[model samples]
Target: MTRALISVFDKTGIVDLARAIANAGIDIISTGATARVLAEAGIAVSGVESVTGFPECFDGRVKTLHPLVHGGILADRRKPDHVAQMKELGVEPIDIVIVNLYPFEETLASGASPDECIEQIDIGGPAMVRAAAKNHASVAVLTSPSQYGDAIVALERGGFTEEERRVLAARAYAHTAAYDAAVANWMTELADEEPQYVGVGLPRTATLRYGENPHQSAWLSADGKGGVANAVQLGGKEMSYNNYRDTDAALRAAYDHLDPTVAIIKHTNPCGIATADTIEQAHASAHACDPVSAYGGVIAANRKVTRAMAEQVKPIFTEVIVAPDYDEDALELLQTKKNLRILKVTPSEEQRDITQISGGFLVQARDQVDQAGDVFAGWDHVAGPEADEQTRNDLEFAWRTVRSVRSNAVLLVKDGASVGVGMGQVNRVDSCRLSVERANTLGVAVESDVDTAGGAQAGTAASEERARGSVAASDAFFPFADGLEVLIEAGVKAVVQPGGSIRDAEVIEAANAAGVTMYFTGVRHFAH
Candidate 1:
């Protein structure tokens, strides 16, 4: 009779599977709890201690680690010498191994103590599974409870085919690999060691409809810590992968502001952002920044969603909305849209930024430069008129908003709100021109009424009214004076940038000649 050894931490579906395996005329050998579960279910089972003739030691941690257990499972049925050696040792072959490791991942995540976590790590289980998997031609290995029923079906058909055994062996190896990886990752975290081998555990969360496009295949997985995986979908359709990416960006931008803020992101770039006393006002101000681009974009708020805010956003076509919480009435109102994904999640405090390169990943700390009140305390007023208190506040706000934009970014802000954003341009001059054009188009530009001044021809009255007093923020210093000239022609009153370019003097001279206030932050904000 073929003997099967079963050891498992997760006992889901074990009793039924054990009964089926026993009814197939196979001898069932299990250890500890698994054996008790099988025997209580009226299935005749042999305990490991009975098979090895030695009791479990070290609080059962040493069970199933003896040579008798390993020799039986690893014997080569095709080799007469190996079979003779096993027979000479009075060892009955263990034709099957049903084993799964301890729940180390869950134990680690549940705030367990180091000692408790260390005790939960299984050594014997992985060894037994690997041994059976290696000798798959003569033994079968089952790693998951999901495979129990199929293994029984194959046993009822006079045992599994070579192909079936090979597939199960493959799965068994992967099971042990993932288990070991989780343990390694957890131990690394506990020891606070810079791991020589870094591994990210990405258990599948969902199979996305497609990746970026329908023709591409995609799947969603996470470290199982936070972000969209933990977000509560109050209502609306399932979130797509792209929706998660865009919402993540929007939430980061929204949380950057201390005041209640709203951020609208499209294609991973912020098109609108604002802060106000109430979420309603913030949403309205952010939407007014670029209503056209805000359409079908993800909107995130750093505060609770109120009914008033829901009503204010009802007219716009938004794809997703995320917030810390949503009032009951606000949730009900937003649910009426049916297809808008509304997610409520407390943003993660900190996370590493990861980028995939040709062969491996490049990991670094997240860009979390504090955007508090004193961010501009050490900034240098390089040239032109000094920024007054109000203009300084606006410049700081614009700088924070510009940090979320892609490289070659230009942002215009007035009254703690982003009026226009130019991003993903090839040149700083184009970014400046794009921001000015957008500000003018959105009626956020100051109406230009003056003739030629500072070698820049002003726009009409409407343009001057919107752009005249707005402060501009560049992610990096201007390489030439032409980009600074574009902002000057748009009637930009103040400029903030990281001053490290060789042409910093020329850029400062242009700002002074144009009579525009300029501040050097001395730190660059470049987002790709």
Candidate 2:
């Protein structure tokens, strides 16, 4: 009679499968708890130790590692010498292997100790599964409990075809690979440095409609826990690739603030960010910062969404809204916006920043500096007038906001809210000019404008007037006085930047001459 070796960690649907297999005249063989389960169910089953004639030793770890178990599964029925050797060793062929690995991922995730986790790692199970899979032309291997019903149906109809056996074997190999990758990743995470072998096994968790654009193909795979993959789509149309990117940016920006914060993201840069006493107020303030750019933007809040907040968001043409939680009424009201993708994300505790290039990828720790504490306590008041307490607060807010922008970035802030931004410019002075122009477009209120424009330039005077009283933040030091001059000419009140440039003295002199307050944080935040 054909023999089927059954061993598994997850016992779902195992008994029913075993019953069907046994009723077809196949003998069932199991070890330890699996054998007891089948025997209690009135199914005659042979213990693995009985077939091997060797007692399970070393805390039952050596039970299935015997040559008898492996010899039977590895033998090729088509080879005369293999059949002769199997008969000489009194070994019967194991036509099927039903085995699932130990729950190592679950054990590690549950905060288990090293000893507990190590003890749960399987040895003989993967060995037997691999052996059966290698000789799949003559034997079949099943790794998942979900495959049991198909196996039973195939066996009841007749023997599994070669194609079926190949598929099962391929799946068995992939199962072992994913299990091993998880273990490797766990070990690497515990190590202080990169291990000799770094393996990333990200099983495809989602099949996206397309990549950056509709013409390209794309998918999302995650090896670790928590991220956009785990976000619950409470309602609305499917999330597109760009939607995920923009939503992540919005959420990350929102997370930077301690108060009830809301961030509006366009493309990948945060167009507006605001913090207030209530979530509704924060959302409204963020939207008001840039109403024109807020169209079809992704909005993320760091607090629970109330019905009032949902009602506030109902009028805008938003692509996505993500938060920690939402009230029942809020979710129902938000669902009325048919195409708005609503997501409740349980953000990951450990964040790793990843960037892909042409050849390989780069991984680094996330830059999540604490922005709530006293960031300006040790900074130098380099030039111009000393910043007052309120100016210092707004300066710090602008400093933190510019940290998220791309390199060559300039941000204009008023009252802890971004009024204008210019990012990814090759020239720092150009970025400053672009920021001033954006502020003028937003109609930001200003104080007096300097006559830096030649011969009564009305447009330049109006632009500089709108940028007056706004603080400016630079990701890096101003290499030349021209960049600081642009902001000073635009009527900026104060500025913050890392003061390590070679021409730092010239820049400070320019600020002092123009009566613009300048402070140096002594650290640069260059996001390239």
Candidate 3:
């Protein structure tokens, strides 16, 4: 008769599995709690100690580490010498091994004590799993509860094929590998040292239709933490690679504000962002900043989507919209747009930023706005008179919003809304010029006077009028005075930057000459 060894920390569906194995004429041997549970459920099961001829000791840590247990699982049925040795050593061949490691990940997530966490790490379980997987040609190994159903059917039909056994063995190895990665990462965290090797084992959650381009095949793996990966899609077509990228960018920009906010993102750059008392008004203001770019952009709202917001968005062609939730009427209306992907996500704090290069990955702590040490507390008034209350508020909003933009970024903000954004430029001076140009060309007209005969001249005056008194933020310090001069010439009233340049004095002189208030944040935000 075939012998099957079963041991698991998670006992879901174990009783049914044991019954099927017993009916198939396979003797069941279990360890510790698994044995007791199976015996109580009226299944005739033998304790692993009986097979090993040794009592479990060291708080059950040494139970399955005996030579007899491993020899049975590792013996190759096709090898006459191995079968002969096992018979001489009185080691019965075990045809099947079902095992799952202890709950180390769950224990760590529960914020358990260090000693408790260390105790939860399984040693013998992974050893048995690896041994059985190594000799998969003769023995079948099952690691997850999800695999039990198929394993039972195969056992009932005589036994698993070599191909099936190979698949199970591969899964078994991945199971133990993920468990070990969790434990290793936890230990590294406890030791408070930089890890020499980072072992990340995220499960494949989705097989994307394609990558950034249709020709490249791609998939998504997730750590199971809350974010866009786990978001519930309420409506629309399947999300593409670019949709996920732009949606994440929009969500990050929206969540950066405390008040009700909306962000419109294109190509992972914020085309427009605004904060207001209501989400609807915020969307309106953000869209007004650059209505042309907002078309087909991914939008994110910090608050729930209401009917009023839905009505405003219905006219525009949007790719994706992510929010915490949606009102019934709002969801109903948005669902009518069949191709718009609507996602509901719960925002979670991100701990790390990972980037992949040719050979390996680069990991670092996420650059958060709050990590800059109290937004305005470390700022120095380097030039001109102190900003008034309204200008100060705009300065703070502009500073927070600029962090989401790309390197060499410059953002112009008026009344807590981005009027112009220039990013991904080669030089800061060009970025400054682009920002002013967009502010005058794309921004909503503040003056509604008609001068149709002098159309171009009137539009320029109106654009400059809208930009006047707007605050500007740069991702990094001004390398030269020319960049600061561009913003000053565009009627920007106040400016904020990291302020660590060798030409800081020259830039400050330019601000002082123009009578523009300039503050240095002492911390730079450079997003590549």
- The candidate maximizing lDDT is 3
Segments of candidate 2 deviating more than 4 angstroms: 40-43, 55-60, 193-197, 443-466
lDDT of 1 by residue, 54-79 (tens): 99899888999988999999998899
Q: What is the lDDT for 371 in model 1? A: 70
CA RMSD (A), model 2: 5.8
Cα lDDT computed for each candidate against the true fold: 0.83, 0.82, 0.87
Summarize candidate 3's per-residue lDDT along 1-528 as a digit string, tens digits.
399999999999999998999999999999999999999999999999999889999888788998899999998879999989998999998988999888887787677999989899999999999999999999999888999999888978988999999999988888888888888877887676666656788666789999999999988876655688778999999988889999999998898888899999999998789888888878777876776777799999999999978877776789999999999999999999999999999886776787889998999878786422357766899999998888888888899999889988999999888998989999999999988888888755422221122221122323445577799999999999999998998899999999999999999999999999999988888999
Arranged by TM-score with the best first, the candidates are: 3, 2, 1
The regions of model 3 sitting more than 4 angstroms off are 36-43, 55-62, 193-197, 371-374, 445-465
Please rank every candidate by lDDT, starting with the best.
3, 1, 2
**Inter-residue clash pairs, candidate 3:** none
> Backbone clashes per model, in order?
15, 0, 0
Q: Which wins on lDDT, candidate 2 or candidate 3? A: 3
Cα lDDT for residue 213, candidate 2: 93
> What tens-digit string does per-residue lDDT give for candidate 2 at 291-349?
66777899999999998788778877899999999999999999998999999997766
